[model samples]
Target chain A: MHKKLFIPGPVDVKEDVLQKMATAMIGHRTKDASKLQRDISEKMMKLFYTENQVLLSTSSGSGLMEAAVRSCTNKRAAVFAVGAFGKRWYDMAIANNVPADLFEVEWGTPTLPEQVEEVLKTGKYDVVTVTHNETSTGIMNPVGEIGEVVKKYPEVIFCVDTVSSAAGAKIEVDKWGIDVCITSTQKALALPPGLAICTISQKAYEAAKKVENRGYYLDLVKLYDYIQKKDHQYPSTPSLSHMFALDYQLDKILAEGLDNRFKRHEEMANYVREWANKHFEVLPEEKYASNTLTNIKNTKDISVKELNERLAMRGYTISNGYGKLKDKTFRIAHMGETTLPEIKELLSNIEDILGL
Target chain B: MHKKLFIPGPVDVKEDVLQKMATAMIGHRTKDASKLQRDISEKMMKLFYTENQVLLSTSSGSGLMEAAVRSCTNKRAAVFAVGAFGKRWYDMAIANNVPADLFEVEWGTPTLPEQVEEVLKTGKYDVVTVTHNETSTGIMNPVGEIGEVVKKYPEVIFCVDTVSSAAGAKIEVDKWGIDVCITSTQKALALPPGLAICTISQKAYEAAKKVENRGYYLDLVKLYDYIQKKDHQYPSTPSLSHMFALDYQLDKILAEGLDNRFKRHEEMANYVREWANKHFEVLPEEKYASNTLTNIKNTKDISVKELNERLAMRGYTISNGYGKLKDKTFRIAHMGETTLPEIKELLSNIEDILGL
Candidate 1:
């Protein structure tokens, strides 16, 4: 039996969506491919609430995350980290020989707008990256507020990693002044893990054009140029299987209605948080807690590893705290196709197993 | 009706293999995921005839092509271009600011062994990249002979792009002293286009370690280290759908027996060549012709684009000449799971459509 994935991503995809992965292959250079891609981009724009040109890559969200930093950072980068995912942006900058500085808050704390303003005031940075939702600590940062602050710096490109957020929450890209927003299919999009999509503002493209040494494969400027020249087709042969599924799934998501989907996610998040409070303590404060997943402090000091193992036997699974927080915290994801009833069942099972 | 893919890549995958792509998702960090990847690497070793470590990337083969040039080329790179694919190697190196020089041959020509030796003798180049098969011109370069020449230079890392020929043809990585051999799943592997696999020898790893700025996402050294430390697991969340399908398809490939598979490809190539010679001029000399795809000169000066459109109407598709060779030549791919009778049928349809 497959354990229900209540972990961050690679969530329980719907059976109908999985069937779309088996769609017949198509020549990527043909008109059919361009139409498939164009339709996808149109839907993605509606979801992101932006007029930015959306780009698709045959990689995990990390691929585009790396692309954002390597392609957009010209002078220097200020990466604000709430946890592991934010730190990855900094790591990518350092790996690519891009000059950068890391401004990391505590694992469970959100990156405030004032802190971002202070960094931009330095006038040494050309790029600013923030984690819209940190999967590790379950802290959803105030990206709208941060975007307001970043708008004051016309030269700085604002990029956000919404890998685990996106469809579960409202991301007003244009209103937030987001230059680039990156997310993968597996998270709130509720598809498999092969493709990553991002919205690129014209400013980000112009900023990237000024920077040299944006390596091929992950070069954002080059990708933008190719899509413009090729009528919505990508430079490389993209995963048409993923595109087929995404196109279908996006319809399903839109049919659910964006406002209703966001509301459903919030309801699930509140239920999980309430349950966590009764049993243990929520890791992050109520205001900053992520709507996609809830991180619970392991105050009872249960063996999270063992708990997960037992949960697997019961056909339910959740994530232990990521990296340094392992054993100290546990996480329950309510994103993807997971619903409130499913969350209640998982909690009930956990209660039965733990005899709480 | 779905048109069968006859292009170089994104080939027609078997229905069973396509179904495997719809396999249920699994956490990339799990032991099961490690087993799946480990199984793939072992089988890939047999296919490539090497003991070198096999690394998988979620992006297309170009991703790793850029990785090889960026990570291993420290002093300088000598890129040999027979056609578009080879030129891409040089393009990637230049994009990443890796100091490199291109030694290009005319279209439909192979990179000769003596030419490679002459370039290596210059001693300024520490990395040499060759396209083993040029999909555009259907010229399978004399890479084994070129490898013999590159072996003399102990300091130069040899990289080969076998994207179109890796599984359809035999590649003796260790015997050829090729440090990095790259191929994608959509080609001879008969899988989807989302995954690319490569073999990296210890020498390549050591050379990459000395490089200070290997970008993150496509960083070969970082990937190698992570695989070693994590029991064949990748650092990023890999496309589990691809891995599941690859693991299943590699079994079918091994069951087919490598020698038998190569013989089938050669037999199909010979059959296609005979038809091409009788009807149209064969692009590239017979000695250098690729066994996977045969590029035929449009000797009669017929409209290749119109031919493809007509072919598409009959539930079939073929490629027009690529780039500069467009309309001058047309191509038919006989790789992947394509059979001899299917080739005969396709040719018969083209003959009937064109009044050959």
Candidate 2:
């Protein structure tokens, strides 16, 4: 059965986008590859809203997260955790032996500017990692506000993971002073789950130069050097199939206009949120709800597993809550090429199944 | 123009294999994904001829290479370099801050078993990295012989990169006593250039348990644990498109019969080698020449650049020597789904172009 993906990621890729994955292979060292990579980087720069060097990796967003924390954290790192994905950054720091401290807020809460300001006041950390959109909690941290605070600590490299929100939300990487902004192809980019894309500021690259043991495969310095040295080619073979689809999708996205795309996501979020408000309570604080996916409290005490099973029988599937939040909460993701009508159909199906 | 890749990797994928990549996306956290992953792992175990665990990564083979050296090397590493790819392992060790030493023979020369014995006799290393096939030099190292030598040093973790040779050559991971054997999708696996696959022994897993700083994304221990915990899912989202193709292609490769596939590759290698011997000398020693890709010395001093240009015009592409060997030698890959007729055609085209 073709169950539509309403999960946080590996969401519903368009048929056309999926077809692009079948594009014939090309030599990684060829001019065709260099051109393809260069084009993708250029398009990604526009999507990321930054002039920083855009890089691609043939791994999940976690790979880039590890790279940023390991490469840019020359002295120490202060990792802020709003939910699961945020906590992952701190884990990545520890795993790579990058000295770091983690600060956590309540699960459904956001990472506030005041908290970031207090952390930066220590001045001991050289890097700070933030989750722009916490998929686990459906909480979009006030990164713009946090960026304002982070800007005050010029020495601290600012890294933001917009994995679940990059294209759906407006993240002005340059204006927001984000030294390293990371995202994967499966999220708001509306592509398959292979390629990881990120932008590295000059500051982050310089910081990486001072950091030793950055590791070869995910080393930001080596990645950056290779791109600069050989046009946009990577140090190792990349997923050219993903790159081909990405290049095509980015064109379609730009044609739709960034503003229009963001509005579409907002419209879908508003619709989903309004439905949840009537049937159940939203998990995250209303002021900071995610535009890409919504986590709803199981106010009716419904079995999420059973709900998903019912949903799947009807040719659709939504996610049970992440980790500890499972069963207590269920999620409805509306990002990445999911149309307003599709979202409505999904919600209506849910309503019918629940006898609401 | 549709240039058929005669390069070492990112080789020409069959249309059916490419179509598999176009398969619909699925939620990474779902049971469907687990089943898909489990199926791939089980099939991969057969392909690897190992009872040990098979893990997949969304990056290139180099990713797993880094993982093995970084995760399994606790005390120190002795990296034996026969060519560019071999040296990359040593570089990965240094980049990850793993204590290591590089033992390099001349570019086209093979790593002798005696050299490995001498290194193991030192008793200073806990990990040893070798290349099963060096793409750059067109040299397939005597890993079977070297494996025999390595077996004597029971405590040393043996890592082999079979990137360009895995599916085309017969590598009995269990019989060879290899702790970690890595290969990628684009090589003899004949998929695309994204996914990396490897088998890890219990000894390597235990060694990894004691090693610190096995960064999150490529952490072999985390990958193995996750597979065990979740029944074959990865720690992060994988390249599902590549997985789809790999699952399908593995069936095809197996249906062709591993013995038949090996014999086929050997046939192609013999035909190409004989042709090369007639026109020019093979780069590597004849006994050590690779059965997948053969590097031919530019003995006639013809313009390799011009030859490739002519070949490209006729919808074919071969590689010049890697890095410093460029123009001084050229490579013709006969691995993956490449057949005898295609090899004959490519050779015939080269003859017409070179007037040989």
Candidate 3:
């Protein structure tokens, strides 16, 4: 059965976008490939609202997240965590042997700008990692305000993981002073799960050049240098299939207008949140709740696994909370190409299954 | 025009194989995904002729190559270079700040067993990297022979790159004592470029455990642990679209019978070599020529650029050498699903274009 995905990522890719993945293979080093990559990069810059260089990788978003932390952090790093995804950044720093300290709030709470300001005042860190929209806890950090706070520290590199929120939310990268903003194709991008995309400021690239033992595969300095030298070509053979589809999808996205797309996502999120409020409580504070996915507390104490099984039978699926929050909460994603009508239909089906 | 690709990789993907890439996306954490991955792993082991654990990465083959060198080389690495890809291994080691020494053979020559035996005798290196098939030089190194030499030094971990010649050539991974054998999907796997596949021996896994600063994204130990604990699910989201296609393609390859597939590749290689010898000189020594692609010396002084342009007009494309050998030689790949009739047609078209 073709179950509709309301899960966090690898969300339902439209047929046209999926068809683009089947485009004929082209030589990665050829002029045709350069054009494809350049086109994607330019389109991504518009979407990200950044003048920084857009870089692409053939791995998941975590690949670029690791790249950002390992390559740009020459000194110590202060990692602010709100959920599982935020903790992953700290873990990446530790694994790479980059000096880092993790400042984590309660899972459902947001990372406040004051906390960021307090950490930067210490002068012990040269880099700060933040998750703009954490998928696990359904909390969207106040990155705009946090970015304002980070701007005061000229020496620090600010890196944000907008994996789930990128295209769904308005992220003014340059205005926010985000040095490196990373996202993958699977989430709000509404594409398959192969490619990861990011934009890096000149400051981050310069810092990356000074970092030692940054590794080769995900080295930002090398990646930036290679693309610049080879006219947007990667050092290694990339997934051209993903690139072709991304190019096509990006066109569709731009045609829809960024503001309009963001508005659509906001509307869908609002609808889902309203529906959740009527039956269960939203996991995060209403003000900081994510616009891409919603984590709802299991107020009725329904068996998530059984509910999912029933949903699956109905040709629909939603995530049963993540990590420690499993069974205690459930998540319904509203990002990507999800429509208002689709959200209503899914919610209606859920209500029928649960008798809510 | 839909040109038939004869390049070393990103080679012609059959329509059936390409169609598989468009399969609907599924949650990476779902049971369906686990089943897909487990099936791929089992099939890959059969194709690799190994009982070792198979691992998959969403990046190109270089990602896993970087992983092996960075994760397992706790002491020093002795990188044996037969061609461009070999030098890349050394480059990766240096970039990661791993201690490594490069042993280079002439471009067109193979890495002899004597050289590996000599290096292992030094006892200065704990890990050794070898390219089983040098794509740039069209030389298939004596890996089976080199493996015998490596067997004498049980303390040294052996990593082999079979990127361009795994499914198209006969490689008995277990018999060759290969600790880490890596290959990407694009080449002989008859799939689009994206996923990289490798098998790790128990010895290599143990060595990786003791290594520090392995990084987070491509950390082999973490990847291994995750797959073991989660039933083949990766720590990071994978390119599930590729997995769907890989599962389908593996069935086709296995159904064709491994021995028959090997024979087909051998025949195609022999036929191309004979044609090259009749009109142009083959680049690599006849004894060590690859069974996947043939590098032909431009002894007739024909303009490869013009020849490719003409070929392109006729709905065909072939590689115009690589790096320093550009224009001096050209390559024609016969890997994956390329058949006898297609080879004959491509050669006949080339002959007509060159007036040979």
Candidate 4:
């Protein structure tokens, strides 16, 4: 089926991005390969709103998220969970055997500054994790406010999962004092899956050095060391194809203007939220709603499976509520290269199918 | 500035392979993504000489090797090291906190069947790892003979790293009792770096079930379970761009014929070895020399780095010996999609530069 993805991630990719991926291979150790990586990192630094170095990995964003927690959390980690992705941080911590404490909020609720402040007051952790746009609940956490709370505890490494929020929303890594800010290509970046990019502060690097057994491949210190030594290249072989596509896509993103791109996402989210408010309920509070995607409460007692079936027949597909919220809500992602017209079209089709 | 790599890995990639990587991006969750992955895996099965399931990971071969060891080693791992990469298996195990023992052989020496038998006879391990081709020393282990030794312990999972030898060497995965055969693109496969492929048996999957804390991203059991559920797709977003190139490149490889490719590699290795022996000395014994690359002894007391610098001036790059052998020896990688004509030209250039 030639269905367009309206899901939270692995969203519809542009043909140009795909074409960039198919570019001929090059020697990874060659100047051409370094040029490709260097270009991607420089552009990625701009996208992440950081002047710090950008590191690329071939794994999904979660890998780096895991790397961040494992690498930087020498004492303990205070992981705040607003939704599924936040929970994933705790899971990643436990799986890597990193000592961490989980702070869970209700599914549709966002992580608040006060909650983070309360946790930071404890001073028991050297690292903290926050998920910036939780795809499962469509809650965009108040990371900017939380950043204020975290900055007071400079010893604590602030790691943000900007996987779904980065390109759709603003995340000024340096400005917000986030030590490690991670994002993946498959999300709002609108590139293919499999590659992740992050910016690590000097503080994060220091914290990583203290941690032991931070396994190879995802070893943050080793990666940072290699980049410093090799002039922006990764220690291991990188996904050159993805780097090519990313370099091209960043130009498109920047040409659209970063603020303009953020606004487009907001515009799409607003359109979907308004439409859902009239027909059903928006899952997250209007004050905490995500700019990248909207979660619609199934107030009309509608079957999402049936709605999706109808949507699929029309050559479009959105996602159901994730994990515990599967039937109670559904999600519509408006991130990445998706345009205003595409969003309107998907909404109209959903409305027609739902008879709203 | 137009330097060609002959460094065992990150080999000189063909223009077509690079071109394929420039393919347009597609949604990873879409049918297109599934098709690409399925196609790559099916083609990879042919490359590994197995009907077993092929899993694609957006990591270097080391990542998958770590995954295999971490996931499959429930009791203990008996890692046999012929060179650096073989020692890497033990490193991964120790780093992951997995119980493992190393059976070391001298550098540039092939792992013997008797050494494997001695270790397995202890019955202290449920997993064993061996590197088919050790890039650091140019030793190709006797995997077939070692396979017979491992077969005695049916409960023990056999993992092989063919990072530098996969496509250039014939590895009958099932026939050789290899529960996990790991390989990456950039080497014998002659694609760009970034992606690694592995063939996994049911036993390996079952073994991973008992091992806790396999870690996210490289969790082999999770990967296997997710693929079974998602039509060969990964739990994490994969590197679709690499797959696009890999699919196209695999077709080219198959078109050239696997046996013919192996023969070409052997001929190149023999040619390089003979030339190096006549000029200086062959590092490994004739019986143990790699079919993928040749390590040359620095009998002339020549500076390997200086020789490489001289070669670089002529637009070619060969590797100096790694680790302790850094200045004592040098290496010429004959693997990847390198043709005999290209190898002959590279050798002739070396001769011209060295005036030997």
> Which predicted model would earn the best DockQ?
2
Which CAPRI tier for candidate 3?
high
True contacts kept of 3: 0.85
State the lDDT of candidate 4 residue by residue for A83-197, as single tens digits: 8889989998998889999999989998999998998898898898999899999999888889998989879899999999888898888888888999998889998777888
Question: Each model's TM-score, in the order given?
Answer: 0.99, 0.99, 0.99, 0.92
Candidate 2 at residue A212, lDDT?
Answer: 85
Evaluated at residue A16, the lDDT of candidate 2 is 90
Tens digits of per-residue lDDT for model 3 on B121-220?
9889899999988899999998999999999988899999999999999899999999999999999998999999999999999999999989888889
lDDT, model 2:
0.92
TM-score between predicted and true chain B, model 2: 0.99
Give residue B33's lDDT in candidate 2 (0 to 100): 81
- The deviation in Å at residue B58 for candidate 4 is 2.0
lDDT per residue for candidate 1 within B1-356, as digits (tens), equals: 89988888899988998998888888888899999999999999999999999999999999989999999998999999999999999999999889999999999988999999998998999999999989989999888899999999999999999999988999999999999999999998988899989999999999999998998999999899989999998888899998989998989999999999999999999999999999998989999999999999999999998999899899899999999999999999999999999999999999999898
- Chain A (alone) TM-scores for all candidate structures: 0.99, 0.99, 0.99, 0.98
The parts of candidate 4 lying over 4 Å away from their true place are: A30-39, A300-315, A351-356, B1-4, B14-19, B30-36, B299-315
lDDT of 1 by residue, A58-154 (tens): 9999999999999998899999999999999999999999999999998998999999999999899999999999999999999999999999999
Name the regions of candidate 1 deviating beyond 4 angstroms: none
Off by over 4 Å in 3: none
Which prediction has more favorable lDDT, 1 or 4?
A: 1
Q: How close is candidate 3 to the true structure, as a TM-score?
A: 0.99
